[model samples]
Target: MATADPRLRSRAQQQQPAPVAPPPPPPPPAETTPAMGLDGSGDAPESSGTSSDDSFKLKFCTVCASNQNRSMEAHLQLATAQLPTISFGTGSLVRLPGPTINQPNVYNFNSTTYEAIHKELADQNTQLYTQNGLLNMIGRNLNIKKYPERFQDWMPGKPRLDHKGDQGYHGTESGVVDVIFTCEERCFDAVLEDLHNKGGRMNRPVHVLNVDIKDNHEEARVGGQAILDLALSLNNAASEERKARGETGWDRGSGGARQGFDEKVPEIVAAWQERWPTLPALWSLAWF
Candidate 1:
């Protein structure tokens, strides 16, 4: 037989070993799936990054136009839900007041039966003026009668430290920010401008949660529940894995005021603040 060419034989043997196909590209990174946090809700995660201001730990901030119905409900829900990798707050440092309660001849602060409400908002500098027209407007815009049980249970009767453990807007970003959120389109734009001017989060991701404002108290309550559920889902997504593995440092105190809801709320809020860093203007709505 003719002597086979060594180079050609070697090449043929190598090729014959088996046409091993190149490993397929890694599924294109799974498309990032909308940043849904812990709660299983589709709510996007806030940005995470080092802030220009090293002193503060807010590499991100959530911007909302007014700390009233929609935004305040989101704040409370996020606080209670314990979202991970993110913090929550209104755009400006001003505190927000809860909705107005029914009263008679409430001209000044003391004259009003809802003085605690006043103080609650006062602490945060949230001034909400509820006229008779606003009530009608709330009735038209929201369905308060939907979730009465939840309203009675979670709604803060009187806004107190509701700060979820003495926490307030530090007014600076000095932490890792995963994203920023806004409650309303307007607020989102304003925050965008601020970020653009300050080069916010060194060009991080941002989300907008556009929601309608409610004049009716009960409708706002329903909306609050929706927000709470969404917040819980998002929060759960980030921390559930860690919590399931017996992780601590997220306000797991044994007893005291934090025995139940009190302790859990602040812990969740703090955790969220640390992770999300920034929020846009919009309501946290959950689908399915």
Candidate 2:
């Protein structure tokens, strides 16, 4: 073979060095890596205080036929049960948007009974106005003055029902409510239909409990007691459930804890029936 030029030989030798691949491009900025700049297993997952299942709030709407005796009684009873996280209100016009009927006699009935109850409570020094903590009591324990400011003007015996078709009941915008209690089948049907059609705060699921009041005394005494009993028992179950689950909120000790209506309502209903036999004929539990 012919001898190669020294310069050419040197060039060939330099070129002969094996090809070397550039280092693999730095791994794409690991998007999965947490912002803390630590690799996997380095950081904790985001922690929101509330449980994922507990995202929704619980609300109760006590709707009744007249909103006078039966429904009003139920509302008062439910209010007193004082479940920690629930909100309560009573009236034919509260959630309704349109005008409501007026009972000229309502002022007479609601005022007289309310004042009598208020005066009695005042003597006991448990007057609602005097004691902020006792405002939610109803029926035998009701404090008219301590009634919520929104309900301050409500007359107990007064006809809460506006006979004129001008009135309507509507739930608020706070959020979806879990339950609705109505006294009597007619009332339950009407209220449910209204909620189904004209929806808002009540846009969520609801449960209806009807009360039967065939007679005036039963309407007044048994009706009130049954409603109250239902509320108290239901709330109590919720409290127990919450306690078991380690939930923290208001009125935990006093049976005021929010509960899943579906989970606790059946037991509550059974408990209520056991407490008051008359309650069975009037009540129907439904969910929507």
Per-residue lDDT over 183-274 for candidate 2, one digit per residue giving the tens place of the 0 to 100 score: 55555445444443342231223455666655233354446556655555554555466666645542222223434434566666766677
Cα displacement (angstroms), candidate 1, residue 230, comes to 2.4
**For candidate 2, what is the TM-score?**
0.42
| Model 2 C-alpha lDDT versus the unseen true structure | 0.36
Writing each residue's lDDT as its tens digit, candidate 1 over 111-172 gives 22123333332332222322222322222112211110111011111232222321122321
For TM-score, the strongest prediction is 2
Q: What is the TM-score of each candidate against the true structure?
A: 0.34, 0.42
* Model 2 stretches with alpha carbons more than 4 Å out: 1-59, 77-177, 199-203, 215-218, 246-261, 281-288
C-alpha RMSD in Å of predicted model 1 compared with the true structure: 25.8
In terms of lDDT, the poorest run of 10 residues in model 2 is 6-15
